[model samples]
Structure formats: structure tokens, C-alpha cells
Target: MHVLETERLIVRQLRIEDAEFILELLNEPGFIQNIGDRGVRTVADAEQYILNGPVASYQQNGFGLWMVALKESGEPIGMGGLIKRDILEDVDIGYAFLHRFWGKGYAYEAALAVLHYGRDVIGLKRIVAITAPENPGSIRVLEKIGLRFVKMINLPGYDEESRFFEVDF
Candidate 1:
């Protein structure tokens, strides 16, 4: 189901049928490098990811990463939304888009919408984000969305420290 929309994009919940797109996206070199490999090697694995990740998040937290698609063509371009990581104290916003779609304003647009959703709709008092320390692109988007740099954090299970950012409602 559709969760949010921007002038140029539609943000919606992930469904099993999105396996193909998810498979390709999870395997993107950039995704693996920045977000870590999800080990989704097949469409079936993507299906499981949807069911176990986003779908489960929606049920458990009332919010999760949603698919970002071109508003006009309904073509999937990326995913963005709020994530509640157990390792973090506050809910955080997360997103990943295809490499082909990089350099566009979609990440910022979708992130802005999701940040508003977390505060205004979900009544969250604060939202945080963590990005690979070397990911300047993501850091730029986070700063653009009003999340200020807090510090570098070493999240559990990660090999490197992440640049932590946050915004208070």
C-alpha cells in the first residue's frame, strides 16, 4: 500500500511482488559497499527479505523502509523511510537508491518526507541516522534534511564507525 508521495515519487510499502526489483537493488555494488551485503542472491531471497525486514518492521514498529518509485511511471527507483534499530536509542531514517538514480534529488525529497512523517505523523520526538563515515553523499542528504552531525559511532556488527546525525521534533 502507498505510504507517502512526493511530486516526482511515490513511497509505498514493499510487497512480495517486488522481489525482482529488490533482488537487483540489494545486489547493487554501491548498496553492498555502503549498506553491507544482505545475502539476497535470488528473487526468493528478496521475497524473504521483504517479509522479514520491511514487512516485519511495519507490523512491529508502525514504520519501516518503503519503496520509492517514479510517480509518473510507477517504476521502482529506491527505498526510504524510518527504521528502528535495536542497537540505536532513537528511530532513524534510512534509504538506498539504484546507482543509476544517483545525483538526482530523489533521496533528499524522499528523506524530507519521511522525516516529516516520523515527527508529525508518528509523533516521534527525535530521529537519527547513521551512514558509513566515507559516504559524503548520504551525509549531505542528512544535513539537507536538518539532521545535524552528532558524532561518529561504532554500531554493533559493523566493521567501521558511522557518522551519526539526528534531528529533534
Candidate 2:
């Protein structure tokens, strides 16, 4: 399902057909360094991740990480949307783009759109975001989207602390 649109991007549901793109995005050095490796070493694994992660989330939770694509070419550039982590109290806005798409404002535009969807359509009251403490770029984006830094979080499986931020609707 197509969810939202920005001036330059289209945010939509992820499909099994997106495995190729997911494989590349998940293995990018920046994604591994900042978001951690998803261990998707093969295309099959990527398909499974799409099924179990985003597709399943959409079916069961009504929202998940959406594929962000260029409106002009319909080329997917990243993934972003509402994530319901078992460890978090509120839905978190999560996103990651291809390395080539960095520093281009797509993250901000996609995220800002998702946040609005979370509030206006999903009826969410509190939305949070987490990023590695050293990721200044992500921190800047989160802050730019109006989520205030709340604290450092050591989630159940993380080896290091993640900076947590939140915005209350």
C-alpha cells in the first residue's frame, strides 16, 4: 500500500520484489555501522526479512518500515516508517536510506511525513526514535523532525547505548 508522499519521494509498502534493494541497503557499511548488520547475506534471506519484518508488521500491526522511492522514476532509495518494537513503550519512527542518498534531505522529508501519518492517521500519541550515540547525522535528523532527546537506552539486545528521542502528540 502506498502510504505517503513528499515533494520528491513516495513511501509505500515493501514487497518480496524489494529483496534486491533490501539486500543492498542492509549490507551498506553505513547501515551496519549505525543500524547494525541484519545478517542478510543472501537474496533468500532478504526475502524472508521482508516477509517477517515489514510485510508481517504491516499485516499484524497496520504499519511497518515503508519503502521510500523517487517519485520521478519509482526507484526505491530507502525504508522508513513506524516500528513497534517489543522493548519500546511507544511506536518508534525508523528509517535508513542508501548511502548514495545521504545528505539529500530525503530522510528528513520521509520521516517528517511518517510522523504526521503516525499522529493524524494512526492516532499515536507518543512517537520515539533511537540512534547510535555517535551518529550525529541521524541525531540531527531526529532533532530536526521535532523529537527531543530524552535519554540513552540500552535495549535488551544492544551492546551499546542508543540515544532515544521522543515527541508527544
RMSD of each: 0.6, 0.6
- Model 1: per-residue lDDT, tens digit, 1-169? 9898988999999999999999999999999998999999999999999999999999999889999999999999999999998999999999999999999899999999999989999999999999998998899999999999999998899999998999987
What tens-digit string does per-residue lDDT give for candidate 2 at 1-169? 8898999999999999999999999999999999998999999999999999999999999999999999999999999999999999899999999999899999999999999999999999999999998998899889999999999989988999999999998
Worst window of 10 by summed lDDT in candidate 1: 160-169
Off by over 4 Å in 2: none
TM-score of each: 0.98, 0.99
What are the runs in model 1 whose C-alpha is more than 4 Å off? none
Question: What lDDT is obtained when candidate 2 is compared to the true structure?
Answer: 0.95
